[model samples]
Target: MTATGTTLVIGATGTTGSRTAARLMAGGHRVKAASRRATSIPGAEPVLFDWYDPATHAAALDGVDRVYLIPPVGESDPAVVMLPFLHRARTAGVQRAVLLSSSAIPEGGPAVGTVHQALPDLFQQWAVLRPSWFMQNFTDTHAHALSIREDGIIWTATDSGRVGFVDAEDIAAVAVHALTDEHAPNTDLVLTGPEALSYDDVATILTEVTGRPVVHRKLSYEQLRDRLTALVPVEFAAILAGLDRAIAEGAEDRLTDTVQRLIGRPARTLRALCEREMR
Candidate 1:
């Protein structure tokens, strides 16, 4: 893609999208940062874009050849709301797409997976990033971080389940490569960190890094669902709980070298990520 062609970043204020936008800007590529509220990034053009609103889609896709897709959050079935916009993007001459999907959600599965499966058919140059559970979940203002800060606890239903939790920064680096490189990986890249770790390991890492008594509190699926329902819809809460259940069943117990292979460096370790974020 030409350096002059604008790369539209959906959910530009989000974890991976924001970092990808920054990386693109640093590389001297044109970036259009799109979100619901027009938030500005230093070297990006901010555009208002909403999934439910088709009017916002054309304006966001205008003069754009590449896009970083961040699926709608908190929605059980995001494809229903996003596919139309993606079609619009293609119609508007967008040639490349990089979708941010989860490790647990396989291609053709519900949610982002549906979009992942559809991308190859929609665009000639496309890549799907299926990253493991994000390390930011424990450091940012997410539920895990909030619980750790407020009560010194990391609660989850994935008892003793180990995951190759990846850093959002690494994910973004790979995403930038996918978006700009001439020979982008035309297949889904399952990204993970250097090691597989459980929540207990994460708690220990947190305690050591922050010098605080952080503990992992494992809850039953029912209890976890109940706790999440207060914050999200019951259906979404159940889906979250179901993911925990899948983890407990050893679904996420694996690691991959995709990040290192693609980015020419090893993936970041959880300890390293915690040490950096804690400071």
Candidate 2:
């Protein structure tokens, strides 16, 4: 199906949102890059938007029918803030939506999961992109990246549990497809890289690529929660630690073809991402 009309890309300055906005613009679709700040993207319109502020919602949704939903960060329950805007969007004739959710958060589970459950009922053309841990976590804003850079250690509570880490770029590609395709996926897409690897395997890859001694420091759930508590709310820290506990139970060990099936190419591998970041 052919794509038409302007697409509002919320969190357009973010990792995946930026890429998706660029791809849509390159494909000849008009894009409105929405963020809390009026961050400009060349060749796309920029608008000030924040989920917590309903006043900013209308102008950003103006003249836009399709939206890429990136939930507000650090909020334990994003649905509370985003649902009202979504209701407004639907009422304003917005037809398609692609939400960036997480693999660990199933529909009706937690966090963005509540929004995932509501998307299908709100819009006939909607997709929830449930991606595994981002490969960029080792090079981006995440704490793991900081530890790797400073102490050459990757700390986690997953022990030997394996995860099919996906790249943010791959997730963006899938999001583009979901947003622009003639018909939306109308369901949740589990996105992951080609292979599953433990934190130890990731450290090994970092060692090989960076020519440094990188190691994985396995911590118990309690230890992990303690480490995170200083940075986030206790409840939120516990939620994050719970994901690691799920990981320990082998929750993220599986792989999926959703990326390749949707984008017609294999997802980027951990080695490739490491090599690129190292250089």
Q: Could you give candidate 1's per-residue lDDT for residues 35-142 as a string of tens digits?
A: 999798898999999988888888889899989999888899998988888898899999999999999999999778888989999999999999999999999979
Compared with the true structure, what per-residue lDDT tens digits does model 2 show for residues 25-85? 8889999999999898999999999888899999999999899999988789999998999
- List ranges where model 1 is wrong by over 4 Å: 1-4
Score each candidate by Cα lDDT: 0.92, 0.93
TM-score of each: 0.98, 0.98
Off by over 4 Å in 2: none
Backbone collision count in every prediction? Answer: 0, 1
Error of 1 at 246 (Å): 0.9
Give me candidate 2's TM-score against the actual structure: 0.98
Model 2 score (lDDT): 0.93
- Clash count (model 1, backbone only): 0
